[model samples]
Target: MISCVFLATCFVAIVADAHEAHEPVVVVDSDAMRQAVLAWRSTLGPELTRQASFEFAGPVRTDWHFVPKDRLGVNWHDMNLEQRRAAHNLLRIALSSQGYFKALAIMSLDEDLRRLEASRPNAQNVRDPERYWFALFGDPSSDEPWGWRIEGHHLSLNFSSVTGQVVSVTPAFFGTNPAELRDGPRAGLRVLGTEEDLARDLITSCTPAQLKTAMIAETAPGDVIALPGVEINFGEPEGLSAEEMTDAQQALLRNLLDEIIGNFNAELRERALDELEDAGFDKLHFAWAGSVEVGKGHYFRIHGPTLVIEYDNTQNNANHAHLVWHSPDNNFGADYLQRHYAESPHHQSAK
Candidate 1:
């Protein structure tokens, strides 16, 4: 036990030193988030804890998808009202208020879809937001590595931390069907509205020569291109570079980026912007696909080194929309995993 503790201490020391040498790019609201999740765990017994967890190295950690399906871990329906409220607390802390509100709005769409699709055979139970599941991978720890996920239809948020420092939050995704409600209390609601409108303004402003390089396809894909848990090989990015944008167009681009990434808390937004700056805005490629008309099938992708944002509105007759952020270098705890593996060369993740 003493030897194990010694080794762990030494490994942590190395990570700490590395961290101190650089600015904390990935800042987590750790105290609040930890307290929330830990509070939720305190309400569960050992069996419940075990049932709600998987190894950090397990397949379950990578089993993220945007579709609505039953997933492991304690779900909203499995919890009583109190537990449900606690889950919302976790979401509130982890997400920006804008993000939290967007999530709530997206969840609300499920009821509309359920009512609209009840006639479909055996599909009535498909869109319950209460079915969202939360699972902690590995034990909850402030001095060791751990991760968690809260996922359901139209939403998937995965976060990774080491010794309470958040290192990654991706492939984060948020999507909505019936992207706009034509008539209802929710009429004119567009959960991912800014992502679409801004991209269109930029794409439409593409000059004839610029459009040639930016228009990758005649039709948009039905969903975001990069799949979960995989590196996206988008090939050499093709589009008008940020260096070519007019001042007004550049402002539009900046707004689009903010809308896309500002869904996270301030720290995350800053870290992402820092990375974007490092890559240089001139390196970003804005590519468009499909019809230019509003309320029609369309897609746009902002691709750059270490960053990718995809928005697609090609389903539900272009009324459904999907938006996602990807970090090819940092999904599923990749950054932490690299640091951890460096110090524990002989250590293997618990299977």
Candidate 2:
């Protein structure tokens, strides 16, 4: 009997391993990916760029920033199957193309990653070839669902996808130190050229009357007003609505907005565009701050029903750039959360 029991256990272990090995890998459609890549590249225009490639093997081998194993707020083991899948998908997206761009943005910095790793050994270690250390607390196993953070300097993205839905994508940040350079081997490099030029041109093109409404304040804020952890309160819609603009002006605004928000994948970009359309162009508020002169510290913000874009050209004598797009209602697919909760045991049991 003892021999039989031991043999049965071994069989079960082998089967489990086989099942894991055969799990379907997430395969992004190449054509779809190509289109998205092209759209983003077109926005970049001609710029000095480099390519880096990586292949991840599950969470175990994924590059993640390290944090104290005890402080990880997620309990992955407690999440159901669907929850686990969603969490994995979110992490995959975070680490794939978007994550790659973040790394590339800072790759130019001399010893930036090395210094961060040394100063914060626990917080900055890269665990696997594809995974960097950026968490503090429990491991990201299927056993427990826990909050996890993946950050490295200019790139800081946090996610808490539990029970088959993403909780948040806040503190999602992207910044380029050298927005544009006048000298270097890659001289006249402008990483985010379209993002800057389009908006500037739109504002400059506005009639004096339009500028009166678009430029809410003459002063530029020292930093982005909507910092992390703050409740997103969009002030009243305050700009000349698209309906009010001349056809040419309207076209420019649309093109500029497209260039700004097209940084995401196709699906997300479509959703954002739809939201913008539904909100109506008249509802948007465009506010500017600081000097209007190029190469000077300046900032602009666009707020509408489904979009909020903040651009700051303040660092390095207005050469450094920061831009962000946020949707108050749909960030991290808040709509998906309602569906997930409806099926959750916690909600079902309460009902």
Candidate 3:
């Protein structure tokens, strides 16, 4: 009897290990990843690309403003396997776009990786790790869900995952201090022209009444209201919704939203769109702040049932730029949690 019991225990342990091994892992296609990287590389000139690779690989510690270097951002802890994979690819493509200044952004991330790694040598915290650190959380060998974070000065991309799906991809913050270089070796460089122009066009297109509804405040908020540790509340939608606009105006709104949302690929973009569609056009709002003039400090926000986007270009004589895309229900994989917990044993007992 004792021998039989021991054998049974061994079999259970083996089965558990096998189950864990079979759990889905976030696997990215190397070819897809390479294509994204190359696309961004092509945007930057060859000389800048070579320099960017070098700078990104070098040892340097960038500043950490509001959050601790080791602490993960809020929403990164809840994504599932597939969502995490999509988030990783989305961020890689966004950061590696073509253009000398855009290339610098990638290089800066690389440097941050080296700095983090050097500080934790045994941990191998290089750019690849730093850029996608959030994907490594939880048991790499277990079937249990886990979370990860990607953070550094001027960049924070956080996503959470469960079994194998993404739950949240915000509060994502992307900013550039010098939006354009007025003087330097790379003189007259603008890192985020498309981002800046889209917002401006949207605001300028608004009618007097539309502008009245959209302009939430006269002054820029200085910085993003939600930082690393703050609990964010979805403020009530304040601007005009798509339903209020004519077809031409609606198209303009979509064009601006797409410019921002399209940073993600087809699948993720569709997911965002589905959520937006369910919210309906009447629930959307747009709000603006700061200067009305181009090339000056300014900001705008678009709010709806499932989406919140903020853009500010008020620093460095409207040269600094910051933007964020967030979803309330989807923040940090909250949707995944609902689905997961509902099926969990604990949930069944509570019910």
Candidate 4:
């Protein structure tokens, strides 16, 4: 048998390797991410820094959308290599390893689109992975509140912090053109494969009576934004609640939720989970619409007191897909800001 000391050393080495394998799983407080953001901005000085910064209450922070449209911020494409790396460093801290890899993989698809330009209609140069923009809402170091976003075609991540702790990471959006690159230089690739499969599994697991209430529509819209105005309720919770779901159905629902919101960094992921748990899973609703088969139009949504996760695969013959997670109550740290404003009535978040 191995010596006790050697066995202990082996166990420690295994733990170290596991830690190395999953780096971002370590809890990083908002102050660390804030310092990274400020240090990165300092390199640009006033002009460019001011250009990239925006007011917390400005339209840019609230005028959210996932479609390819004119956005206001400093585009990554315009930044130097070092500046781009600094921006990516902030993202590295802000997103989990799973999320960050998913993001970079989505960016690679831009190259795939470029290669398939003759046949792909979305070959516009706007899809350049580097074209993503970053804009900070205020000074994160100070006591006041602030927010930030790393956004571009098919990817948008919004993060808001109160007093250096992330309070809201809502409106996280991820999408793709050819959900599966069946044939190409980069064939057999599916970034969001699990997200889709889990929901489908939950839907298929439902009983006929459960599905009757769950299937709200025969044809899902080609896309859904889940923005502020979007109706979270398709119609009086048109599906079974967690309380009524079978044991297996409930487990699938929980796992489906875990897969979706758990894409963020550890700290923010816990915050999202806390919000969901506080809302009570029994209060959550799982609904489905459109055809149930692959390569057919389909959509599903998980809506709760403050959380909404929407997925629509209705474009490109059900190849194009959009997924967004929204927390209406805490969006942009609105609830936190409201509390802060009430306590200090005269204090404004942005000077």
Candidate 5:
């Protein structure tokens, strides 16, 4: 279990000016992220900085994945104790406690994989908690827009800031192999259990007619429909929209969406929720594929005009899982950056 005490210490609240005396505001500070990133870069020194820093406009900023491969930035294995602390501080600033702990738990799953696949000669090499990489694009301290990413085998979090405010937090992907650990000390541990159970709850609650409309396929796909690098266009959502759901079912859907959005800091979560509301919550669709049972191959997605959230658990006999959140126009602050550059001619040259 993650220590709440440690989380509190690591992520001390930054209070913004209050609108009223009794209503002091507190939010996840983007300026704090900038400071933390700057500290992390300084700790990395000259040599490692070269490896971790990239031009914000280049393909490198968008070249992201949740696969084990030769990735950009400095890997955890190479960071010293102090440098690692700086990196973690940056994470604490960017992610909510729920999000940060989930990331750590996800990384620890590599050990479980290493033990389960011990027979494979390369398993030990590939499954390592220290394989996560942290990279920065452009200068976080400057007025120009910039971003950062922390990515590894089963996790990828991309954050973008413009003028000291987080403008985008999309393409946030989290996955787990052996979704439920069946043996050993952490037996029955499901890092992404909520993501699975919530969808199951909603789908299982459907009436026969609703199920008929919601089920998109008899078999689950091998993976999520939207993989990295693929242009995300589902055209029209292919399942039951919120408008078709009962009030009780809509409440369940909102709870599920909360679980997903709660992974980000409070400010980002509120912004995201507001975006969903503005996009017409009634337009959001919930689609399911495969068996609606535990330990079975299954997949589900909630997609609408502005947002897309996908979950899949079909590989390794339904033990592997993938969950992702994306936005069509605002991914990596694409739309925000466009407006920013258009308004500031100097930034256009910087890009």
Candidate 6:
């Protein structure tokens, strides 16, 4: 049986706005995100803005998903050239260059899927690179807190800000249906190749005892355990604790984490590292499921007090991959907003 006695502080709280409320604030370097969001909103005009904007306290802010279906907001297909350019600027502000390009690659895969699934009914209508949508919660220029999301097939990025500081960027999800393109123009291309390779390396390097403890199950699940539109609860920590790993293995684990968290800009990445350090990094757990060999279904998780990362490569014969990074204490800037609402003079005066 896996031990539940790892971290003294690793439980999910189901608050009124649990998922978004307690999310930790990883301060962004500048107000670029707010500026970019405002710039993007400017190009939308009144009608599109009405469609894309929502109240910060509304249910829409927490309603996040990464599937291909009708979404509420302005999609790239409906945007003009200027709107598209502004949208890209907003995305660049929210993500690192590598992450920005990776998102673009994921968007491109929609077209690839359209072609590959051409024979399937409704494939053509369902798969389009421009299907990605952008949404804003509250006025970006206002003194109150605000948030935004950009979601489409295989991508969902939720960001929240309070008083010009980016408080949350959780439920950050990225997936690829054809993990490795076989015959497209970008043949053999793997957008999430680093995410896969680093995990495989860490799992394969585990010693006999380490592997025994880390390998939680013989079979990998078809999808990530933490699905969309739900409160994340992984129960207790159930994996090999970092205390069990050697120096080299620990370094490898940190590298894997950096590759994932570093997808954000420099300031956010550094703050994330600080968070890990503040929370007892050695208390983190690494768990693996299924075969570690390439082309075989596999899943792995890195769970800690401040962070949760779940990766699965189990669908389409291990050719589909999903990766997510979430903060337990703060998923949607819950911590920051809670403080802001309690302490802000404007909010207090309104009350």
Candidates by lDDT, descending order? 5, 6, 1, 4, 3, 2
C-alpha lDDT values of all predictions: 0.78, 0.50, 0.53, 0.76, 0.85, 0.82
- Name the better of 3 and 4 by TM-score: 4
TM-score of 2: 0.59
User: Which consecutive 10 residues in model 2 have the weakest lDDT in total?
Assistant: 48-57
The candidate with the higher TM-score, 1 or 5, is: 5
Q: How far is candidate 6 from the true structure (C-alpha RMSD, Å)?
A: 11.1
Q: Which candidate achieves the best TM-score against the true structure?
A: 5
What 10-residue stretch in candidate 4 is worst by lDDT? 1-10
lDDT of 3 by residue, 206-287 (tens): 8898888777788887765555455557567776777777677777778777766655544455567777878786677777
lDDT of 6 by residue, 170-201 (tens): 98999997999899556887878888888888
Report how far off residue 160 is in candidate 4 (Å). Answer: 1.0
Better of 1 and 3 by TM-score: 1
Query: In model 3, where is the ten-residue run with the lowest total lDDT?
Result: 54-63
Error of 1 at 93 (Å): 0.9
1-351 per-residue lDDT for model 4 (tens digits)? 222223223443554676788744588775778888887787676777888888887777876766665577787656776776677678778887667667766666766666667565665764555566788887776777788887777888888887668888877889887798889645766778888898888888888888888888888976874654575444455566888898998999988888877778788778777877897979898888898887788999888887878899898889888898877667778888888888887666464
- Residue 289 of model 4 has an lDDT of 87
Write model 5 residue lDDT over 144-194, tens digit each, in one string: 788899999989999888767888988999998879989987788787898
Give the lDDT of residue 123 in candidate 4. Answer: 58
Per-residue CA lDDT of model 1 for 195-277, tens digit only, reads: 88899999998888888988999999878889775667888777778888788888899999988787787777777789899
The alpha-carbon lDDT assigned to residue 274 of candidate 5 equals 94
Residue pairs in collision within model 1: none
Better of 3 and 5 by TM-score: 5
lDDT of 2: 0.50
Local error of candidate 2 at residue 173 (angstroms): 2.3
TM-score-superior candidate, 5 or 6: 5
What is candidate 3's TM-score against the reference? 0.63
- Please give the lDDT score at residue 200 for candidate 6: 85
What lDDT does candidate 6 reach at residue 303? 95
